[model samples]
Target: MLIQKSGHIIVNNSTNIYEEGSIFIYWEGFIYGFNQQSGKKTIREFFKNLQIHGFCSAISKLHGSFVLVLANEEKQEILVASDASGQMPIYKNQDMISSSLIELTERTDLNKEDLSLDKAVEFVLTGFQFGPKVLFDAIEQIPPSKIVSVKKRNFFLINRDKEDDPFLRTVKHDSISEYLNQWEILANAIRKEKVSIDLTGGTDSRILVAILNHLGCSFETAISGQPTHPDVIISSEIAKHLNSHEHFTSIHKVDEDTLISDLYEIAKNSKGINDFVGMHRLFQLHKERAKRGISLALGGGAGELYKDAKQWRCALLSCNSKNRLVDKLVNTGFVGWGMGSQTPDQLFQTEIREKSANYKKDTKKFLKDIFPEYHKCDVFRLADEIFYKYIIAAPRGFSPLMFPHYSPLLDAAFVHYGINLPKHLRFGHQFYREIIAVLDTKQEIASLPTTRLGMTLLPKRIIPEVLTSVFLNLQKRKTTISLNDPNLYSLLRKRLKRSNILKELVGIGLLNPKIAIDNIPNKNLGRLVSLWLFLRILDKRKN
Candidate 1:
């Protein structure tokens, strides 16, 4: 399912290629792809017909993810193309042959080196690599919606200018009524086999469920954590109200035994430790769903599309208010929950100021690159543009995991609708209020669920007062209890001595210098200690 070239690998399901479906073929000293459509018979036939001298094109018009490579035998050249939105990864190194010749040997017969250390660090910092850069230095991933050609060792890249094409049509809508009408377009976009909904007691998921229900689509719902967990209880209630079947699961503490057994397997398979915790749980859940023959799953993964817009409105309000907005924001959430004795007002201020400064700088650059003509737009407009470019589009990486995973909210139509809404309609607490209203009007919720498992099953009174104290301190600063806290350091050291989990955390913390430095005594060593213990478990498994 995975093929590697020059340290980059492509994943695909080639064994079962349906007629009129997409297929990845490794042939003629290169990779080739054929997409079956109205006029095309086989991919090979298409390639054969388009036999231009000293050049070959690997056209990938399929709906799924793949890398298409075309090599001209006479010219000894190769051309590659990848799907739009970067669903597939295609990497190349211009110096691969030379590098391989120098480094390749019997012990290391592989033709390429792993991702570069600097690139990998950058990925850790940014979450994803931008442009042609990968986690490796010499190797470069081909950008999505692009073609890379090599003719007699001369390289040329051509990007599909979707934004510049005048012939491409644009859909225009008027007022909220037209926007609401587009819901049908969104509903029709949901195409999958054995669909399941990751239902939550929230508005986004509720709206999706209602829409799907209206369309007469059949779907089962799945919820995670104990019955006491807020999402679980709320989702279960919603499912019941909707008269739908549901599956629920619980996740307790990730203990030493589980970490030790599963860490290495996960790391080896995934190739990195970023988001290791969440990914582990997701993988388990995905496997479980896969067993039931569910190839496609839907969730409120893009719920943030609407919710975050509302948050931005609040942020803007705080920015304009005489009263410090940070204080108000901090007080409203879990950040206000007291955990430590430390006064974090100054730290919080500094962090927010730094972030604001960074945001402004980045927004300026983004505007210059993406909307040079819109130079006259105000900060608010620029902010909206940045949001669409960064946050809304950033999570596409998580989408392909569905394989055939389909997210109604993330669908093209839904996103277009969500993005073009008037600023007045897009911002403010009313955004969420409207969604909640829709849920209630649609009767998308069942009953309220209980609290988290740890909170409900574990006696709150018995829980260490220090933990609460630490949390309070973090809340005061609008931050989490970090490893640098003395209390957390002492706790982790004690845990390390007594628990294998703590030992493993220490090991991983040591390996990742950033993790170690971030938890250095000044920041919050206690929190670092806890994270280190987690990392230790991860490290042990990786080894």
Candidate 2:
């Protein structure tokens, strides 16, 4: 890994880069090639293919969550591309490009004056910035599946001749089997590698078990959560059934001081975009996985593309106006995570409140222009994009950076097959259930209950098990550590009292510091603390 601290670059062995002659390739994340090729060779061939065929033709040949930077000294040209899944984020400006947003902004001397009021509003409301927008005005995210050509010295963007993208070629299939068949092929490629699966009680990870079992591939399973949590319990049951080696990491309770320390650590390390709270679990999980001598870990990221398309479908009905619809779409799962007790009028000073009025309008224009169509397919496409942007690409998706992580379900060609499936087949969970049934031939895996629905996928077995599970679970006390608890709120309030970042935001019209810290709703305390921590980091960088 390459660490940039106080404006100096530090190199480490974990940095995944290959250099031969004047050509250079830097990448992080897995590429599951069918023949189990080396990363160096695969990336080299990809660039060679790009030089011959074009961006679309070259990119479609590669699959996995990755960010690739290819520099050619001979041509004085560099190309940057992110995975189609958008799990890896690439931030850039005219002069600098970096995988880390904080590093980019710091190097470019971006400060409070560079902040975008609209994005600030969005961040406060939804706990994330959507599409290509980040917190800084000068820095923008390179959207997924895009190839940007830059000149060597200045890194000025160059226009490329339009090439036919074989990857985006839409093939309307007559049967669902076509999609399933492609899914298996992608799964088969990953099975050849020594794989570690993050098994959960959720349908997504469970589906992975069924598919890998069908492939007759051996894999170790791991789960992170409370010992009594459904995720840990259910994953254990499935692993026991398969007689697979399983690892469990308990999410133990922490002291208030430790919680505060972790939040600050996440804020400093998250590169200035993600909400730092609620990420400790995954951070601990990945930290442990790194020590297990695992070569590569398979995650259930982007599983929503098949298992639950309805989350996106429901956003369309959220409101009548275009901007409202877009807001609903981008902020679906994140709505209540923000300052719910305060409206824009109460939350911001006059200038920022006025600027925030155009937030919905401007955001709708920006994101809709990115995923333009208003049809069912377009809705799902935008939702999937947003998922990658806010969830996968955010600090929450830090699994890849922690350990060798990849999700074959997010394979380029297979996702193309999934999103292109008929609306009826993709919307409900039935499409995924059918795939699970086909893969779990003996019905042993599919018959197991999922953490999401707390019941089996099999119709006949669902009702009875759901009733019993609900009754039994209702009697148990919840053991998971919640950051939203009163102690956290009290600690954060004390910290905010000593910090001027909130006052600075209020002075700049981004927040209303006059609102008593006590008046802030408990649900929103984490968001406030997260924002304050990020602002503190920025303030230090400015110094």
Candidate 3:
């Protein structure tokens, strides 16, 4: 990594005291830093132990998705910690550790002049980059279940064995009552706070509504994006059936003219690889929350960690045969190996293809490191990587900046409960429905079909011929609201021509000028444009 910035570790600053009492200890995410109970644990008692035991200890013992920062005046040092799932990332520059990766931009020099080879390959194939590696190489991301310390000119890590608690070495199943007990405990915390939910027709939020209702809490709900979306219609009905106030449902339409400029700006700042059109509109909803004084909202985040789609990804990876892996990838139209397909592997250039192919070994190794217990369960492990990378990591970037949201499933108690529980019940949301059924609250969540599958929670695969016809019809609708809008491709082509990235890639022999722009679609165009924007935005050091 290039260390070109002059940032001294301040050992002590008497002036750093009391701004908010002239001191600022910046930490984000929901923290259960205290463990007060009949154990008679005081918040001070908790901190005293935390200062001695290290940062991640609180999370292991208390369990929630949070980032904790502990600054010790006595030690003249700072400890930064992220939760077990690494839900909130902490970025480190030569000088400081921060929650935001944008901090790295202030440095004039970077460790890498181009994208990391492994990341480039992975992003092109998978639509997102690997963890602990941001869009920039100079800025390093501190992985989850870690405590990092910066003292004077010294930097180091404080690793605890308890960080591995969520990955529980042995597989065991917790009962339905246990899961509900955990949910009930979490729900009780904000029962008096008038909780607000982005209630959807989906199981995650619906289950949350059921729990909050059973607790007799004051709760309201909202939905955003298309008014006609099944989630919107279903969620509105759910709120009515529960007899709770409906907060709002955003029906704001986006302007196509904005995609060429403002959309790129949003994508760049978001620093996400896979998020396309509707996901980016989370920015607009942020403003809505602030106007409504909705301080805390709830959503179902890690629900997919055990869903059928997740299991499917696992089952494919667990094939343990390269030919089978390649065959599955080809059949699903996911990895276009071109085994007689019209434009097999034509999406990315040959060099990119080869680079991606080579990284599969490294990628498999990476997954193993994250999940060492998954000898026969690589599927669950791989699904977890997807959940963590896209579901938890990408979206949480919007929060601590936009609005704060939580999922009960993300809590450490719930995570441990589900992971240890029978695998079959967890992902299909069969267990989720069981909890609601037991709650004796509204039956809507249990009886209603999810907006995601349109048919219900567990959807049956339609015949390929019928599916193809339906997809083609949907594909023809041509919604301009997409980041993948064909018109945006023209804009991206122009943007590429003006940018120095392609020339730089050519200089590095990473680009083949002849085939760089061949057979690209709106999604591919969007990814390329976003990558180009990342290079520019990071290069220009734009905040």
Q: How do the predictions measure up, each by TM-score?
A: 0.57, 0.79, 0.74
User: In model 2, where do residues sit more than 4 Å from their true spots?
Assistant: 1-15, 44-56, 152-167, 174-196, 216-218, 312-345, 354-362, 365-367, 375-396, 459-509, 539-543
Against the reference, the lDDT scores of all candidates come to 0.41, 0.62, 0.53
Model 3 compared with the native: what TM-score? Answer: 0.74
Report the C-alpha lDDT of model 2 over 41-140, residue by residue, as the tens digit.
5766776776788655666566676767666778767777666656667777766677777778777887777778777777766576666768877888
How do these models rank on lDDT, best leading?
2, 3, 1
Q: Which has the better TM-score: candidate 2, or candidate 3? A: 2
TM-score of 1: 0.57
**Which has the greatest lDDT?**
2
Clashing pairs in 2: 1-14, 1-15
Cα lDDT tens digits for candidate 1, 262-305: 43344333322233433444555565676777756666655444
Model 3 per-residue lDDT tens digits across residues 147-194: 777676566777745535465445546676766666665655554343
Off by over 4 Å in 3: 1-25, 33-56, 62-65, 93-95, 169-173, 191-196, 264-278, 312-353, 357-362, 365-396, 440-442, 452-519
Comparing 1 with 2 on TM-score, the higher-scoring candidate is 2
Model 2 poorest ten-residue lDDT run = 1-10
